[model samples]
Target chain A: MDQFDSVVQLLDSNGSVVANSQFTSTLSQSELLGFYRDMVLVRTLDEQATALQRQGELGLWAPLLGQEAAQIGSARAMQKQDFAFSTYREHGVAWCRGVDPVDMLRFWRGTMHQGWDANHYRDYGYQIIIGAHALHATGYAMGAQLAGRVGSGEAEKDQAVMAYFGDGAMSEGDVNEAFVFAASYQAPVVFFCQNNQWAISEPTRRQSRTPLAQRAVGFGIPGIRVDGNDVIACYEVTEHALHRARSGQGPTLIEAVTYRMGAHTTSDDPTKYQLFSDVELWRERDPIKRLKIYLQTKGILSAELETQLAGEASALAQRMRDECRELPDPKPSSMFDHVYADTDINLEKQRAEVEAILIQSMEN
Target chain B: MAQLSIVHAINQGLRRAMDSDSKILLMGEDIGKLGGVFRVTDGLQKDFGEERVIDSPLAESGIVGTAIGLALYGYRPVVEIQFDGFVFPAFDQIVVQLARMRYRSAGALTLPITIRMPYGGGIGSVEHHSESPEAYFAATPGLRVITCADSNDAYWMIQQAIASDDPVIFLEPKRRYWQKGEVNIEANMSDALNMYSAKVLTQGSDCTVIGYGPTVATCLQAARFAADDGVKLEVIDLRSLSPIDMSTLVESVNKTGRAVLVHEAPGTGGIGGELAARLSQACFYKLEAPVMRVTGYDVPYPPSRIEDDYLPDAERILDAVEKSMNY
Candidate 1:
């Protein structure tokens, strides 16, 4: 049996004030509205990408439909220097990292080789291999520790790494290994597992009978769970975790309890495995809608601002359609580049031979 | 200037690499104060300290996966997998992220990570200890696969691997780890023959025998036995697998018109199979006999008692060598 009792929620789902503990926030109306705005914008981008996939504009699409608050709230919670290693579905987090929407789309369209340039956004490319990036994130955090980037006198100066993987990925051996190393090395990083239930037809029950956060305690790292739909709870919890990491308090596992409102990808049919009622039950805790309602109650959202944001979102979606369709296919010859830093003589010969073959075929 | 075994040479190499580069780190299960099962990483933790020579959790994937992070932070990480068979756990990280990172990053990032594994069966070891899994990495792009045949090669090749900007899969012949040889630490043998070039361990104009790692010694010993019957056999040690030392091989096969590949790995889809196909393409016109392979049977590595039958010994290699020349 698992030991740590998951901090089930530091906040409630009803858009009401709940936790007034040390983790409680002191945010004003404008700041709260900004978080909501960011969430809504990222959701708009995700919806646009999904629509593009439906229209055959994307080769692949991993939807984060209901997990917006989990991603956005947590990403917004990170400081500027805090690095991130994310799985492919962290489009919301990528947006928060300031990645160009076009560069991100190019990856979905299968045109560009990589999703985002790390130098451009300071966010690593979307890692496709499941649970593998957790190790990379931990190692980087260890590197940060070695470089004297962590445990600095200044709290704001110290940096932490947030590694994003899902509940499905929690079962991966690498993720578990990462926990051991992170614990042993005292790496300054956060293991963020967005437990959005399904891992491609396999439910959370299939992954673990117990909650995923409880798995962290076995590794000697304290774990927590938050109401993933409640943006405020996610923000507060992620902030606290990041704070712990930066303060040289070692690694923490955050199991964001949420739901995947859409299919795993454009190729999946959720109806085949999951029930409609289960999906419907989670829709009430919609990440975007809860934030919108909260903003409305606080007199934070205006009709004019809403209309303007909607107009901008539609324009962005249309531009994605136009640009994604126009992104050029990578040149066949260019595949030979970047395999090795040097020419390696042998690869160059192979490249020449291939180019000759390609040219001969064209002539034929 | 001192003589050392392949295992000690490797230990010295690690000490030197870490001593030279502050960014260099070593991690594996029992590799710290316990000094690895083979003692290759012995005393490294004590000399370099725990931070540098780390004792990772007993998880191969985590070791390699975390090494990727160390690489990303400009650290040269050398990861030791306890055994070849255990490396499969980390195979996903190697193929998906480590191999493809530079290509995926478009050269903006490089994983100068070296994954060290003790491969090939001979010492009557139990299951899950003896495996020649280098073929998997050789098949995967963005990874350079190499194996050291002797102590001298072990001394220099490891440093070359460390200096390489790409991810390297370094498979050490565990059975030969204790075999002693003179190693000139000052000598730069990296460019001696060539990184990917096959070395002519023994020269013969009649037929060629190709092998790597532990099998090279066996092939050379077999050539000496074959020489008593006046069969002048040419032996080639394939130091690197992925970018095969084709020029030296093609030249030899073209002269001999007959060749045999040997290894402890299986016959089908083995390095021998790939080398045979490439030879067929490069030296087809020169062929007088079909290139044969003396390798372990096409099956999973059997029990330690049966391993002698599974491995390609001197007799098996000479058997193939004689048949090819007879053709």
Candidate 2:
């Protein structure tokens, strides 16, 4: 299929609702406004986090500048029981899942390996290793299938698993293996590949020869490409895929065609590899801006609502800045905790010896 | 009590665990119908049904990676790696994901997963078939690396490892699969010896000869030889590799005043080296001689024809014992 022609779009780049689109007419005004609010809040968080990293408050930060629609849209499509496995850049997804922004900063702020309780948020935290959690999502989906949580006929009872990865992760062995397993087992999972066009210094072309969505077809799963910058398209596509999964139709691959408008991380220099013209072009297709325009055109985004959202975003940013610095350093002995669930005699001795030395040093 | 081979004992142990826990899953390549390459899981798939016993695709990483997910979803998954050398593909998942999940989650997540792989040399198999890669995992902190040396331990420790909240690297001595011993089938799991405690098979005072997995029988034979020479050798099976059971080793060495470690893995950077270091430190004052180790040479596993020379046998253990005795 032609990459451009096959893309499932609900709204065009200029915020005009696409004519004859199957998904555009189904969206509710409240859901649109909620998506707009989520995108704005996470975008604000992204900017503030980047600034914090530059000011030495955080060790590093992965900025989710342009892919707001893809993360927020897909994350908002899930039910309460559905679980999501995400890469580190899914800050918007985490925000939509009710993770406290302060808790999200714990890892980037160097306080802990994991910031939030994964079980609490139904988000499997941030998987640092590339594409590894794809298999985990597939496995969890398989577990859900075995537990009779799929094809239960009740939307409240049936569950699906979402796996979030970037275009760069398309080349990983684990991701391909996950696809094979998910297809073979007919697992209830949706593999969401946010094709943000770049993986650090490498382009999407470096990772795959064809459109990533089409690659899923080889694994016997339906593959769809969507206008990732358009929040309506992302949500509709993700919802459809998740619905199929919950109904025991097996896995679907949704490639959200987007761009990484910012550097890979705080440490990266995008200027070294990407073109300024490319960045300026993607800037026009901004996810939040298009959604805002669509809301404004539909007479849903009033001046009062805009002002309220702006105030909420600023308040959230302020809270994050205050909490990031105030996050306390962990005790030295905390490192020895949670290595194993059982009492290890050798670890106990090491902990005791270290404790004794600390006490002696303090006494001296 | 019934006499059974190590393979049958492990199979029985898996059956028992699966019978009690409805959420227990068995997943691996060819483990379902083929019953594993060594038939350790024979007839399990037919009895447990396909949902509980899965015959996975030929991908080690997929098997382990998916097992981690199953564990996350509140199922106890027992994954089998087809061979020792084939486990490298899944090493990242085993070491990084499975091992560190609990610690990384700060105890919020617990993976009650057991990874069973047959390891060690002596069956005169191909290069990848016979390998002792236990040290690499034993060095990792969040893992419980334990191996069963005989039928009785195989029967009980498989259940114990399955019941553990932490991830366990359950290594089976491949060459000793057919070795038969009487397993106490009616005994309770609570009454059995701790999986981490080293067992003193035979009591002696002159030297503590320690081995685990495939080499435990070799140590016993070496002890018998030492007895013929009028020397009493205390034979101890170092079952748990990660925790090392240092207290048991220390106690035995404290009494024997000499220690000789044995293994099929290379001596350099192996479990033998770690044991020697710890034993020397703990028994510094009580030691009559330096701790000696009889192990494979530092090289890739050789051809099947020359494996006997490469593997640690009774003669080699005796040589190490004599060296400690002469000192």
How big is the positional error of residue A332 in model 2, measured in Å on the Cα after superposition? 1.6
Q: Worst lDDT window (10 residues) for model 1 chain B?
A: B301-310
lDDT of candidate 2 over A1-364, digit per residue (tens): 4743578878888898885445654678998999999999999999999988888887678899999999988999999899999998999989988998888887777666688999998999887666889999999999999999999999799999999999877877889999999999999999999999977655687567789999988999999899899888899889999999999999999999999999877866677568899999999999999888989998999999999999998998898889888988665455456767887675566457446545755896
Write down the lDDT that model 2 would get: 0.87
Best by lDDT: 2
Report the lDDT tens digits of candidate 1 across residue range B1-327. 779999999999888888788999998866765577677887888889989988765456778999999999999999998778778778889999999998888889999999899999876543456788888899999999999998888988888788789899998999999999988887654544455667888888889999999999999898889899898899999999978989999999999899999888876678988999999999999998999888765556654534554577787677677778677
Structure candidate 2, residue pairs in collision = none
Tell me the deviation in Å of residue A110 in model 2. 2.1
Instruction: Please give the C-alpha DockQ score of model 1.
Output: 0.02
Candidate 1 CAPRI level: incorrect
